[model samples]
Target: MRQYLPVKKFEWPWSRRDNGQNEFSPLIPKSGAAKVEDEELGHVDNEYQTGTPSNQDHNSPTRIQPHYSYSLMDYFLKYFLFLCNLVFTVLGLVVLGLGIWGLSSKESFAQEKIGTIGTDPMLILLTLGFLLTLLCLTGCVGALRENCCLLKMFSVIVLVLITIQVLFAIVAYTVQDQIEGYLRSGMLAAMVGYQDDLDLRFITDEIQLGLQCCGADTYRDWEVNLYYNCSAPGVLACGVPATCCVDPLENGTVWNSQCGVGAQLMDEFTAQSVIFLGGCLGGISRWIKQHEGLIGTVGVVVVGVQILAVFITTRLLENIHRHKAHA
Candidate 1:
């Protein structure tokens, strides 16, 4: 007389058969007890269930766990970070080469002609550009690796650097002459010993023809004697001063009966100053010429860093979304 009762619908984990096996039934309650729980409670529990179901089971792969646990994000981040660092490091190497070339360039020794050389602010621009390029690479690495502290540090450094660069550019462009004058003063300070006071005495044919030839001797008659007597001693006179000559003042020698410390020191100072400043500029130009090949390499590295950043960011976003959907 063992009779089987009708199976109820909507049984949860507690609903088991006589054999102690789960029937895998749905968890809908019967209509009779549905009136006890209010709509608000039902709504709240429903919301909670829906929200929490994604992470309830440890055995299920459909769980919203962090990708860092499996080193998924770590691998990508590391690769991208390495790329960024390598790029910047190589760029730094190139820049270092350029600096060396600048140190040895011949153009640095050439004299700058008057009204020919314009102020370019090259040193400031190059320094800032180099610093910023390094910072951007560092920031990319920090961001890729998800290092919060590094990221913050890099961000702050970059921001401050960019702000300074912008301000400098603004000021430099607005007061270009003042900036040029400042730079010129600095150069002069470094090369002021090259200044020289040149005393150039250019003697022409008139001054060379000393004591111009006088025909009064050949035509020394009564009329010539009378003409000579009536004529001034210096006016239109022959055998006057003739033949030009350059009378360069001897070093340390007094001229015009004036005596002081040796003036040759001034000439030496002028020559040395010119040499120093000319050497500086020549060195810079030489470096640019010597490391010309490195410019392309540096450009490539920079582009590579940018590309890697984009790829890593995309991969991170994709991984997050994929894991989320599965969960």
Candidate 2:
């Protein structure tokens, strides 16, 4: 109309040309709408970079890595148990060796002596040593290799042994009089065969020397033996062993084997001066009473150590299960 000429359209520097429509659109606009869109894009880009949005829902479960750790105490206890068990294993081997030596020295495997093998003190030592060695070895290897089966077996055996010891201790404490009677009977039986059995003779001699005691009841108790009886033809008749004498040495050096000859013929007043009048049973009882506190302390410590081993083994097992689960 007014100019009757074509009007030139103004386009922003950031605008794009629409070929057919001749429309111009800005890639980046300067309006508030453009500002809002720019902020939204920046937020999305931040989310992509950080892996999550800042406005994430609080109720949603979070993803975090599980932490597995062992403290210094754990390592210390593990090795400590291993070392303790190793020491016991060595001690067990020593005990087993001593037992074997005793049996071999005594010719206990002879056909005639084999009948008494079951009741031999060396057999007891051998059995105890073997069990200790086997059990401790299991625990040692198990701790080192973290073997669950071995640990469980060790734990079960220890538990059973503990239970047995507890029951034995209880019975010993509750029926002391009966126990003493049984001890007396056993002592008498040992005396009856003291001459025939070298093992019993050695044991009896050791008991007499260690306790400074004569016999089950008195020095005359040796007469129960067939060779020591007053009616016997041997020189040992009515004679106690040299071990029962107050002084079994002559001139302070020579062994006075005949010092106890005719000792049974002496009166109680005279015999009291030559030999110990007390029996081994009383001496044993006195010894036990005197050392009860020490015995209790040792027992408690042993039980505590076993309990600690069980606890450490259980913790290790739990750790293994946890690691496997995670894996």
Candidate 3:
């Protein structure tokens, strides 16, 4: 039979009076036969005095505790989160891969090479895509882990990156011509235009002399004949040399024979193509948005719809099965 010293007040780190030993012990209630009897007999008195808590009263602690259950709504939300994350991750990887590949290889060289799909532009696009993908992947992991903080962070980052990319793309598409010209100039700055191939009139003595001196070169000779005529008083005739010109010649001889400048319209077409592609990318973004849940609420709606559809289909199938069984 263990004996308990009468407790005054149950203070933490309780003090004990000792006979020479000075040893201290916790004031635990004794659990002997006599103590049990006392506990049973004194139960009402204890209740009146200290108010012994009932099962329900003690249950308040558990009731106040947060729920850790996984509901249907939770499952639906997770599924939607997983779906959106997966789509973004895959699409982002595709964009990053193509952007990096195009930037480094001439094999996929784009016409507006500086930044329109193939050059430095591809690298920028790739970086943005990579970041967006990473954010989505992070969001997916957070969802899997049920980490609200991580999900919020990732969502904000993705939203910001998307906005920035859209704004810049729009601006770039708007100034497509100027941008292309800038890119082209940077690419071909090392060489000069072939000056002697330009047409030059030699309708005066000084011009004729200059032509005679310079025309030894094929480019200069071509230029001289391009604008030469027999009608001028002080200039040489184009075909017969300096002495042959006496009087009038056809007006055609006054102008260069080359009818038109052979300017290529391919550059213009390429700029147009770049603008078109920008529009397409925007469309793709819209398509992706359609699949995403609102504040991640998309999952609930989808699951509900799917569940309804499944229930209907299942009933129809069951009816057919019953009909066949009867038949």
lDDT of 3 by residue, 1-327 (tens): 235776577646447544453222235455568567776768867777876554546566543534344456546666676676778889999988876775566433545544433223355767978886887787677666656566556655655555665577578769966765563343222111112211112222233232222122111122223223233243323232221122213373563322211111124343222111121122323544675556236545644543443343333334434544555
Best model number under TM-score? 2
Q: How well does candidate 3 match the true structure in TM-score terms?
A: 0.34
In terms of lDDT, the best-performing candidate is: 2
What shift in Å separates residue 18 of candidate 1 from its native position after superposition? 31
Pick the winner on lDDT between candidates 1 and 2: 2
Q: What is the TM-score of each candidate against the true structure?
A: 0.30, 0.79, 0.34
Worst 10 residues of 3 by lDDT: 190-199
**Residue range 1-327, candidate 1, lDDT tens digits:** 235767667857777555543333334433434445555567778878788653447556654654434365557575666566667656765665554354234243246522322322223334645764676566566655655555556645645554665577578669956754564454333222111201001111221122221111211111122212224263312111111112223363533211111221234344232111122223333555688679657855655545555555555555545655655
User: Which model, 1 or 3, shows the larger lDDT?
Assistant: 3
Which residue pairs collide, candidate 2? none
Ranking by TM-score: 2, 3, 1
What is the lDDT of every predicted structure here?
0.41, 0.85, 0.45
lDDT of 1 at 215: 17
